[model samples]
Target: MYGVDACPNTEEPPDLPALGTLLVDTSRNNRVGEFRGGAGCYWSLRPMGGGTEWEVEPRHVRLALPIEQLRARTARANARSRGDIL
Candidate 1:
C-alpha cells in the first residue's frame, strides 16, 4: 500500500518571500517583480509595470535591492501616468 513515507522528499523547500514583496529574477535578466505566490516548485511573479505573471525557480530569485525596488516602483508609476496600466 502507498503511504506518505513511501516517497518522502528529502530536500527542504525554499523559503518564500511575503506576498507583494519585490524580488529579482536573475534567470530572466534580473527582471524586478512582486512575489505573487508559489506554483508547485516554482514561484509566480508579477511585473512591476503590471503585466502578465511569470513563474521561476526559487533558486533563481532573490529579494530586490533597494535601488531595484525604487526603479520598479517608478516604472509602474510612469506606466500608470501614461494609462498603460490601471
Candidate 2:
C-alpha cells in the first residue's frame, strides 16, 4: 500500500468550484445561485436571474453544474421576456 486508503470503499471530498461561477447552496434547500465574489472569510451570492445579494460561508455553497446554469439562465430569460424582472 502506497499511503492510499487501501480500503477502496470511501469517496474523496469534491474540490471547491471556481469564483464568479454558478453553485447550489446545500444549506438552503439546494437553492441555486451565482458565486459573485468573496467577502473576507465569506462569499457573496445572488439569485441566478438577479436579486438582492446574500453572503454565505464557504462551507454552505458548492459549484453549480452546467445543466443547472443553463436552466437558471433560461428561467431568467423567460422572466425578462414576460417583464417579470426589470
lDDT of each: 0.88, 0.71
Best by lDDT: 1
Evaluate model 1: give its TM-score. Answer: 0.84
Candidate 2 local lDDT, 1-74, one digit each (tens): 42442423244434445666788888888878877777555567888677887877677777777888899888
Q: Candidate 2 has which clashing residue pairs, if any?
A: 23-64
Compared with the true structure, what per-residue lDDT tens digits does model 1 show for residues 1-39?
547434233366588889999999999999999999986
Regions more than 4 Å wrong, model 1:
1-10
Residue 46 of model 2, lDDT score:
80
**How many residue pairs clash in each candidate at the backbone level?**
0, 1
lDDT of 1 at 8: 35
Highest TM-score scorer? 1
lDDT: worst 10-residue window of model 2: 5-14
